[model samples]
Target chain A: MSEWWSVVETARRIADGEVTAFRVVEDMLVRITRVDRDLGAYLEIDGDGARTAANEIDRKRKAGEKLGPLAGVPIALKDNLVTKGIVTTAGSKILAGWVPPYEGTAVEKLRAAGAVILGKTNLDEFGMGSSTERSAFKKTKNPWDSSRVPGGSSGGSAAAVAAGLCAASLGTDTGGSIRQPAAFSGVVGIKPTYGRVSRWGVVAFASSLDQVGPLARTVGDAALILQTICGHDPRDATSLDVPVPDFSAALAAGARGLRVGLPKEYFAGELEEHVRAALDRTIAALRDQGAEIVEVSLPHTHLALPAYYIVAPAEASSNLARYDGIRYGLRVEAPDLLTQYSKTRGAGFGPEVKRRIMLGTYALRSGYYDAYYKKAQQIRTLIKRDFDAAFESCDVLLTPTTPTTAFRFGAKATPLDMYLADVFTLSCNLAGLPGMSVPCGLTPEGLPVGAQLLGKPLDEVTLLRAGAAIEAAVGLGDRRPGGFA
Target chain B: MPTLTRKEVEEIALLARLHLESDELERMQSELGVILDHFGTIAAIDATGIPAMTHAVAMDHAGPFVSLGVLRPDEPQPSLPVDEALRGTPKRDGDLIVVPAIIPGAKE
Candidate 1:
């Protein structure tokens, strides 16, 4: 068996009797053991649980029963997604030892699809930071460059897939969590339309903005995983009650005759030279393939980051108010309930979490509500309108996923500097559009650069079609990080 | 950009129910001030005619399948088992999670 097997190949091989599910899972376990020590991609490696599930898949196959689409595929979940009977922590000391009694809807869907639960991957504490550096546990290193951070709050999921620790992993995106990390790690990550996936048991982080998606080696793998997880769920009121489209069928449509819009505001900023080159390469590839590339404008792009900061943190502050230490997490004893709440939270949350909570609380304060929170919401409307207008002229919009390649640890000295890392990816979340990052090419320094595709609401099909085209044109196939490979 | 005072940071922390050390409070004051300053750009935007988009489904482009509001029939459903509900509580007395006294000067 090859070490770097794509999710599609893994499932097909296992289904065709070319490989046993047990053997596939065992190989993944061995690879994770060998590779994950330096990467810190997984918070927990559920070897026993994964093997048990693999054995079940093999049994079902031997019994001549039809298997699910992801049968025998080993996948990891971002720790923020709860798994019943597994110790699930949102990379915060607050949830350090909490074992969820219920599983997230996505995890349940993955299990039903016969995907092996490899374990939960690390994330920014409560999905708060752009880089996994803010995780309360071990920081996930970029598989491409150990010295640099794996972009986060989905950093662990992206790194794991890049390192071949798992076939693919589920990552939650609020602002740019999943896509940014996938870009930095050189993998395919998609943030489905906000209401497309149910968020039932996932840890709440800026509830309105959060959406769970897959990070994988190829766009098809992501589509398969997304197919299994997305649908209307009564448990998640915000879930869209739309029929799931056949994404795999859509991939073959390619970029021909597609109207790809290049958002002018996205290109107006100071992008790193390598990133700019990669974007140009992607645009050229699409145009060469008969995709009509037109320049479009999203006038309110500059205000996206500012509005996101206010909106995400404001919602986070309210959603996180449930962790009062009296419930299902770490508790600090104090003479009074209020003091205990304060002490527990102070001790549990990391610096970034505290900072966001403070900022959010202040924004939602009585006198400042209209100025900060309300104003940000209004700006959100303008951002959404900008996308709506842009989409009218084009089938999809393309841009660089990040302003630069992955940076060295501690390169972003200030919180604001770190926040800027997600500037290019934030507007999509605010507008609730489906966004994907596909690797375009490697920089001169050997770091991978990604090109982002933004689609209209619930239009992941167009993004996938364009992404697969980019994937083929770039032709960076089966590339693995040096040491890991 | 509005700079937060030390007192303001402390007040906000209290409101957020986070106990901060003196050093952390100082750090937060400076950091929050910088972020708020950046947020001034959003404040400067003229959005007089725009309505606040509290949810993504509120957008006109959300498509036919998505409803602005989803209402499930209100019916009795099986809740989490008592043991499961209390499974992760830090301090539990039987099935009930234990908490500090809500009233001041109350005995434990």
Candidate 2:
């Protein structure tokens, strides 16, 4: 059996001095060495760094220092987060072996709170794909079924948490990268509102859409991870200046009297039979907890995917332009400058990354800008307006995190088909709303089903409150992936 | 139903600084064409006078582009050490990063 504890439980045991921090890190490292080859969730393990951090935590405890909230909790970081001296590849060959000189604000905050980072997890190259197959390094397998892919670009982070590789993990979500994988791996993933978590030191995909959040075994663990890393950072101009509410406190408040809207647009079509059945059960359970299920309509829902494909790539092209190989990362040389740029980029980026860059470049070209880029931005406004109107009737909107569950590897061969996998979760990113995925049920075949909760912009407290209630009622925590355990 | 032509795909590859093999180029011709066709719905929408959304979250009204909330203040502060900043550079010569000549010996 595994000695892996949830985030909160691990912290409590460490804070109480019942378990040494080094011991905890060593145990997790042991488990990782044994199982990570099968799961492929981690790209690299920082065993020495983690041991040193854990030893410091233990020393602090021995010195009678007050323990921080996440004292001794083992955490995994998505490879995109800059950790000084740790390679931050963002799952792209272009950045292979590039170690960041600075730390991202989120990683910095986690260390301050006494979290020991065990390793960097794999991701879709630059977080560009809905599935982890886009990762150039390693494809992360869904913990529930090795034959199936872990939904990604945050796939490895989600898989690591679900497989008990770490107490918690942080993953950045641009369009459902965090939540979709969390859903696929049967864990809880939260993508805070666009500005809630600072993006400084995190490699950018689409600057406006990317936000770092947590994946964990439970809603409470997600809350604990969020609490440690949230708050304004001067470095990130877009970071919210607003104070973070006690997310853990929100977990205590049950779903009583909360208005949970079931958006008709989300449930109307394309849902698999098993997933719909699970979502229906989740809705009934929420209703039993006194959450009033209001049926709301987000009329412009279907337009979101197309708009996101435009907006995200357009931004990605600009954000990814920094990889000229003159400054950081892998560089390819040629006789001339332009040739060098082409050669390095051609060799560095994967097909998915290249596809986005090309599409984005095409969309933003002068003549087509008004038709493709501007028009997409306008649709973005409409999508946000749809959410604005829905929030007037309900406190939080509920939907299936994905249309189906964990899909087999190579299932979505075409780019468009893969993009459609994020259909339900994309709108929340476009609207800049706080959204989370919590495991609710499983299909008859044993694949995990994720029920998503989306709240108004900056209204995560409401979303988490409902999600916690759903989590409590379902007792989804006990439903572990069999193979890893 | 806008579709990208082969020439257009090649042109876009040049602009993106990507050198696509013939196979990849042919694939993109069909893939990008379909992607653009899907996005045609955006163009189909009536968005006259509908303001484009530039930011997902409203700005602090004091960052950049003060008209619509830009970025953090322009104030200067301490930053990374010079060595740390240069550490990731693939080709650095004692604090100076070396790059291929762009302007063709205008100021080597």
Candidate 3:
């Protein structure tokens, strides 16, 4: 099997009888078993489930039945996205071994599309922090350098794709959870416009900002997954009523004649020299390909991180109030009911989760709500307006996905330090626009850095076309990190 | 401004229902101070007259993409068995799933 065959390519080959779904599943299992020991990307592997699904797809193909578009392709899901039978921990001991009775909308979509369910990848506890180090279970190591981190809260999914544990994975981005990790792991990750994908089955970190998206080896694969999973669902009140575009078709059209905007504020900070150089090179390549590059300013960019911390945590504090050791997760034994409640919660949640919850509670409190949470919401509007104004000038905006490559484990020890790690990508979630990260070039240390492209609302097609052009120019398709067993 | 005194930090921890190590509480007090310092800047932005933009721009209507439906379904569906529903509970002793007391002001 060729490593470069995306899920779409593999499915085509399988449908034509050139390859069997079982063959692909077996190869993935071998790769996961061989490499996942060190990476710790997966919390649990559903070998039997994957194999059974592949076999069923293979049978249908042989019988001349029209299979789904992603038939027989293996995909990993972030632990936050619920599956009926598989454990959904959201990378926290508080919900350890907790399996939801209903499948999430995205999971149901994948199943309907006939994709094989490989396993659940790890993530930050309740998707709270920027680094997966906030995960209560285990830290998902960077495949590029085992000692460094794979950026998070979707770090595990990004690491899994980079390590070849799975062809692609689903991750939720609420303030750069998906794209930051994608940048650090050198993979393609897309955050659909907020509410584009239903959030019914996924565990909520911040209801307003959370979005389920795909991380893959190629932009087209991510697009294919997005097309299948996105749509309005009655269950999610915020879900958008919109048409799902044919992203693969858009990819075929390429990025010629597209006007790309470079946000000046994104490049002026302590951004690593390597990342700046890589984006400059990518911009030159896009210009050479008949695309126009223009300078755009997002004046409210500096307030994004501050606004995100307040608004997200406030919503998170409200959403996570359900986990009070009452329904699921860990419970501690104590003398009386009050002691039980206090002790159970005190013992269960990790440090970062506790920190976020407290901050959120304070922000949402009676007197402070208007000052903190409400004020942040006003700024969030300004951030969105900045994007809208930039889009008026250019069809899309470009920025470095992250400020730097993956940092060594324990690099950002303080919680506030970790929150700053998502400086570049968080604004997209706050503004509710589709954004993506594509590999541009490697750093002096040979670590990969990614350039992000932001498209108009519900304009994932434009984002994918831009990404495909960059991926094609870089020619860095399907290069797994070194030392994979 | 949120000062986040040690006493307030402890109170917030109790309210959040998460146990914090002593060192963590001390550290959080200082870190929160730094964060609140930054948040102070955002609080200063005057948005008195601007209307709130909660959701992004709505998607363009190409056709009848949204299907209107009634709220209630007359048909009933099979539900999980009581025994099976409580299978993974941490502290279920009988038909009822046991849990920590949820009464507000019951604990310190």
Which candidate number maximizes DockQ? 1
Segments of candidate 3 deviating more than 4 angstroms:
A1-4, B53-85, B100-108
lDDT (tens digit, per residue) of candidate 2 on A388-408 = 899899999999999999999
Backbone clashes, candidate 1: 0
The candidate, 1 or 2, that scores higher on TM-score is 1
lDDT of 2 by residue, B1-108 (tens): 778789989999999988788998998899888888876677778889887887887664643222233454778889888998988888878989887777876531
Candidate order (TM-score)? 1, 2, 3
For candidate 3, lDDT tens digit of each residue in A1-485? 43346878887988888889999999999878987887899999999999999999999998999899889888999999989889989998878988777789999999999899999998889898777888888888998899999989999999988887887899999989899999999899999988789999989888878999999988888989998899879778778776787888988766689999999999888988888889888999999888999999999999899898998888888888777665567778764665666677777777777777888988877787887888888888889889889999898889999988899989997777888888998899988899999988777686888989998888888898889999988736546677662
**Candidate 3 — which pairs collide?**
A346-B19
TM-score of chain B of 2: 0.77
- lDDT for model 2, please: 0.89
Best by lDDT: 1
Question: Model 3: what is its DockQ?
Answer: 0.41
Candidates 1 onward: DockQ, in order: 0.76, 0.64, 0.41
lDDT of 1 by residue, A6-71 (tens): 788988998999999999999989988987888899999888999999999999999999999999
Candidate 3 structure lDDT: 0.84
